[model samples]
Target chain A: MTAERSRLNLRDLLSETAVALTARPARTVLTALGTILGVGALVTTLGLAKTAGNQIVSRFNELEATEVVVSAQSTGFGDNTRSLNVIPWDAQSRLERLNGVTAAGTVSAVDVGDDLARSVPVVDPQGQTEFQIPVMAASPGLFGAVRASLFTGRYFDQGHEDRADPVAVLGPAAAQRLNVTRVDNLPVIFVGDEAFAVVGILADTARRPDLLGAIIIPNQAARDRFELGGVESVEIDVAVGAAELIGAQAPTALAPNNPDQLRVAVPPSPRRVRSDVEGDVNALFLALGGVSLLVGAIGIANVTLVSVLERTGEIGLRRALGATRRHIALQFLTESVALGALAGVLGTSLGVLAVVAVSATREWSPVLDSWLPFAAPVLGAVIGLVAGTYPAWKASSTEPIAALRGVA
Target chain B: MRSLRRSRGAPTPDDLDDGPLEAWAVPTAPAGGLSFEGEAVPVVVLHQAGRTFAGPPPVEALKPTDLVIERGEYVAIVGPSGSGKSTLLHLLGLLDTPTAGSYHLDGIDTVTLSEPERAGVRAARIGFVFQAFHLLAHRSIVENVMLADLYRPGGRDRRRERAVEALVSVGLEHRLDATPATLSGGERQRVAVARALVSEPSLLLADEPTGNLDTATGDQIMALFDDLHGQGLTLAVITHDRSVAARAGRVVGLRDGEVIEDRLVGSGMR
Candidate 1:
């Protein structure tokens, strides 16, 4: 035989294989559905899980890659053990001013703002647009530490903090909601009593990408409006190269070798309980996804075995054609992989569609977090191959002559 | 009666030259009595071939068959139902294992062949036809014929051409695309014959090729077989049909697992 014929033989074998499957496509598709759906669910869920997991990691990285956040004892008896409480803003400011130290800041969570909604009467050619933004506060240098630079206006200095000016810097979402051309000269109504002018507008970034309507004010001005009695969360930064030296200089009274992420509260607060609930929900879905993958495998096995039985004569014909056992097995495995890949691509599209639909309906821009698109189809293909192997093995081992006679 | 005389080596009148002449009878050696020419390669040699199935007190399907067929001679094996005709064909076809025997097919003893090796021999050296025309139902006539050599030493186009040539010999060239089911009983049998011939095997062993057709149709298939035989193809047709048996130049008849008759038939028998 010519080399061309030999090289082209495998393609013929595969084409024959595909044609054989196509002859009874309804049954074949029925057989493959479970594996497809199972693999689909597995891959799609894994995609989402990876998305969520990297989101939390990004959030952790968002705190600052090189710095360690220092926490204090709780204000009361119950608080999250993992939650980093208030670190005394004055002490934090002093640490920032230390030699070689970069900027540091304390974070204050926006607990239920009482009716001080950001109101803007935005006018377009069609009609007027109105939206509201929640207000939040942060310590001085929060912008510098978080790297939220202004696009149009300047950040509040010590003067604004001292004077308690009715001024605010707008986040991207807040600017968008106000329908404003520029935050430099726009007035936004705040609460039932007053209107505040936007001093600065935050720029969009990948680090903390999505936008939610909100206004950030100076910590001093915020204290006048709301109580800063409980320190919700804290963030700190170390100088470029002083992390090790500073850790060593800590008082010997506190054991230096012990890990520093110590959460000392005996009981958890409502916020801690809420985060726990969210974690449980995530775990529950992940567990369901794992079980569905297993069910999908069983489905694949069932279909493959039945398909082999149905195509017993075809198997004999192929074997009689000088196909080795490995060839038969590889063919079936290839078919399974193709089906699984198809399902995975379809399932990923469906999942993304589901997320997009939710986002559109809820009016919340859900973060897609990086790394999910590449991981989905590969997982689907692997699952398909593993699930199809045993049945294909059984098919490959069937005796050719007996198969011709249609004997078991 | 020669009484089934078998000598290990060639039993000859040469022993009379030195020893007592009474042990063997020979007046003057007849000039070249019963001599075979060309290669004495023993294309098939079965030494004490035995096969016994372990069922209902071990039914022995084949006895210790000591037989041989020369390279280019058409030999017909005739037997009744369960007379071991099919079993003997299988053993010679390299499709079954002998419980005890040295079956040397074409100078290669098959007792030592692996399964794949046995199948290879079956594919390359022997072709078989079944009574029911065991063609793949799903494929067309040409494809059915082509399958015999699809995985053999050729490309698909060449194999297809060979299959078409074979089909043409049996006069089914016009029905290449028709499925076997669409062909008549006689035509289907011809297609089966075409399939067996496609591989160009050294031996063609057909089991009851015309047993299922009418007299005229049966005669047609037998006529085709005869035509192939005249073309110098060595063939073995297994059947109880007297006419089909009558067509062969030499017929070896089996009764109760033993050769009961070996004779040359005349055209009047058909």
Candidate 2:
């Protein structure tokens, strides 16, 4: 009977403490709001940061190299602003023929008329846009250097090159734009009034900007038909040991157009870019998430302190009723922790909403991806836990008797 | 001690023994009364004990006075307002430490115990009934009673049963689940009594327990105290009413922190 009595006492104390919190719920809720906003702000910021990081990673993948880029610049050829590449076919061929070089490829900036656009988005009333996608056109052996595989049709060969066949492979971005749109063997106009046949559509690559509308062609065809009769630029793909060696001869042959365009490089594997982009995105998320968590802590602290004051008489009663000092402190702190955690949950949900909002509007491929819809909740949960800690601590430190006597 | 004896089934005027028992009311508990070897006793001995409040000018609220209270005795320490009545109660309750001398409760030297130990002793041995009732507004009547047992080890169901039993003892079974705020002034005091007795303390102490109640209600509460005394609990009460003091076995009148009269009522055989 005696043991039963004491046990009942503890249960009653905790229940009563919780009850005390509920009595001034309006005030408690008001205090809790601070934590909510703090957590929400943090989580949403984290979402944006993650998106920015993914954008950067995707950007890196777009620039993924067969060899480290020594430099880059405009092609500077006359009347070629609409051209897709600065690196011409002859320069790439010459670079590839070097002893230590494995292969060579080239890329350029091009403005393709929106192939599938009913209309352009994020533009002014003039019908012009700031969105310019990266376009790469490669020589015959370039595939060997960049390690890209053809999804269906074969990569360009010498016969097509010699005849300047104009058969082109569409990159992932272009393929997505033309998803099941059935444009195989269709005539597509390009630089120098060339008419090209769409051989195959490339899947969307994680690489952004450059790989979006990439158009690949063999060297012979590029040299015979597309070359503007000079060194447009050179992109050399050399062995690791010979990266610096290409620097020696790069200025000699291509300096006229290669002012900064002669890019001597070592290629990165596909896997490296994928993981790197994910890591970058996560780092950005953590930075923003951390800051918001601090806000949550402050919110929790304020609420707790207020509660301590409001419940002063209640605390005094508990003390008189057999509650120890430590018990009082623990009870208040526990309340704080609960509030912080609830706020965290709310904040995380807001963050997920942010990601959803972004996904609804922008067409840019996000670098970091979550599993279909559920990943948002997981991300939110993690952010919430991190943000709720300090608030919980602050809540737990209230002195029981003083807390009881404080006005709500 | 014979004057402190009860007439068993018939409650007598001097049956209640008041001796440092009021502090136990803070707990809604069980076994607040003292016990070690299957028996309980109330033995308070205050020797030259006093308290000083550290204000801008330190106020000596209580004067050193030697006192002793035997087991099963109902004693009323009477005094006028601000005549050190509350101060003496606080000191007896162990809620405050004395600035001088020493005190003993149930043969245990209080001055020598650790702070936490003192708290444990207070929890285990005292039941207090305040003039204001001081019931926690948030908890139900049963919960309030249960709080006194918080330091006592047991399971939930057992504690719950004891809480109900305590409420029944104070005739508050019908309002077991009602919060103090929902109770009337008299009912709240009854709940407070339930909370105090739930702990079954060695000493039942009252600091003007009926001060907030009307005359009839005050007398009813006093009668309730008289009935508890018949059950052999030690009680110490502080009151301004002469009639309230008249109900105790021994009445000690205080004038300016000094005991002016010590009188016995009814049978003073022991």
Candidate 3:
């Protein structure tokens, strides 16, 4: 009989807890909203941070694993500055002969005698000075190295580079500035009194983003017309895990006697980037989640206290029914924990939904913690248990006679 | 020492009862009540039991007094307001401790029991009904009766069956699922009585059970009490109304925290 009674106590407790909560549905729901918002904000922030961080680290790893850049060190300022170890005109061919080298290309800035190239024969009557376009000379492989995509016409071939024909391609920005949208018109742009026929307009580039705002001409043309020096920079793509090795070998390959004069740049190791990004993302959102949880805890405490005050008569009745002080305290604590558990379950689902929506809108793959949905409700319940301590104690301490006086 | 004296003499009411014999409106319960075999023990025995309030004035709420009530007896403690009728009831119900003297309930020394132990005794042996009917507004009449069983050592199904039987005994079986809010004043009081009876306690303690009802409704409730008393259930009612006191088999009157009169009604010396 004693065992059966004790077993039924749990069922009785739950039934009584449910009755108490349902007695004031509006108050219970409003009180639970605090935990809902807290948990939802926490989970949503976590989901977004992981998704964004994953994209950044993946891109960083991909670039760091395969690409290396070698630039000639500048000895002085201005157009007269001498390159201590200028990249050889045949830098691409030399680097390609090395193991693990997939592709290589050369690029050099064009010095147009301190004058900007203009498509118009004369200046506009309004005297607009917004079209100061910069120009660059590129080899054929530079287009492949930089991953450039053409918008119109065609890229200049090896035939044009070998004959030194003054053919050019305009970047999207440069093309807009020159009022040349299509290559069908065969537009001519003068570079320091020499006219070059525009062959193509580039839409975008992967490596050399700065090229979007400049014009490109054949390297042979720049060399013959302007007495251009050797290539200013060589960009090389190698197989994964070969960046450091190839970075060391490319400089020596380009300038065997002056390898120290060239600076080879490769991205930082992948391990470092992953930790840095993860740390930043976790720290930022964790604080926000913590603050939200604190506010939720306060809300639960406040509501539990108010409930204890309102149910003083009920407490007295239970006491009269032979409920000990501990029993009273346990009953109230159970009600609090039940409220928090409800909020946790609802909040976690809402948060997960929000994450899916945001990730879908941003075109990112959502990443969620595997155990968070199950753990969150338990955490909320624990918070409720802690928060209810004072109120439950106050309830249990109520003098049975004094409480009954109010009821009578 | 009191228990030793009682054991040595084994005195019945005919030998040396304290209260004087008198005639009253109600009759005593018949002999052959549900008698416990072996030895008969009074349900309540108070020897110089008194309660004092800890106050600026140190008010003595109940004066030291001796009282005894045997099983199957109907008793009423009658007094005006502030006469300590409620105080004496509080002591009898185990809701408060006396500042002076010892109290023995069901032949067990109660003064030595802890608060929780007192609560356990109350759960197993005493049933209380109040004037206001104190039914939980959110629960049905059946559920209200079932509250008593939650504290008892039994299966839920058995407890529920006992609650249903108690409600049927109180003529409230048809209104089992009706919440207190939907019940009339007299019906609500019946539910309270059913709740008190559900645990099959040894003694029924009621304080002003008809204080809040209309005279007609109050009379009906008193009639229900008389019927319960006729069935060999012991009852103690504390009230200010002489008319309510007239229906009991015995009456003890209080004035200024002291007992002024004690009397038996009808042909009642068991």
* Chain B TM-score, all predictions listed: 0.80, 0.81, 0.85
lDDT of 2 by residue, A1-408 (tens): 011111224455456547755877776566556555655555555555556555555553433433534334444477753322444445566666666777665544333444322212334577433323333455555565555555655566667766778776666565544342335445353433554566665544322235546665544455555443333334555665465566666544544554454454444444455556556655765666566556555655655665555556556555555455555655665555555555556655666677657755775443223442343334333433443344334433444323432432
Worst 10 residues of 2 chain A by lDDT: A1-10
The local distance difference test score of each candidate is: 0.61, 0.59, 0.78
Please list the Cα RMSD from the true structure of every candidate, rounded to 1 decimal place: 13.8, 12.5, 13.0
- The better candidate by DockQ, 1 or 3, is 3
DockQ of each: 0.08, 0.16, 0.14
Off by over 4 Å in 2: A1-17, A52-141, A146-310, A324-326, A333-408, B1-42, B55-57, B151-157, B266-270
Query: After TM-score superposition, what is the CA distance of residue A385 in candidate 1 from its true location, in Å?
Result: 6.7
lDDT by residue (A1-408, candidate 3, tens digit) is 001111127888899899988988888888888888888887787777766777676786665578888999988889568766468777878988999888788888877676667785656688653456777888877777777899998888778888999999998998888877888888898777778899999988878888888888888999887777768888787888788889889988999988998999987667666667767777877787778877887898899998787778777767766677888989989988998888888888988999899989988888887888888888778877887888889999987666766754
Docking class of 3: incorrect
lDDT by residue (B137-185, candidate 1, tens digit) is: 7678998887776444333546777788888878887899998778999
What does the lDDT read for residue B111 in candidate 1?
Answer: 85
Residue pair clashes in candidate 3: none
Error of 3 at B269 (Å): 7.3
Candidate 2 local lDDT, residue A55:
58
TM-score of 2: 0.61
Query: What TM-score fits each model?
Result: 0.60, 0.61, 0.65
Give one digit per residue, the lDDT tens place, for model 2 in B120-224.
666667777877676766667887787776654322335677678777776777899988888888888888887777656667778788888998888888888
Please report how far candidate 3 places residue A191 from its true position, in Å: 43
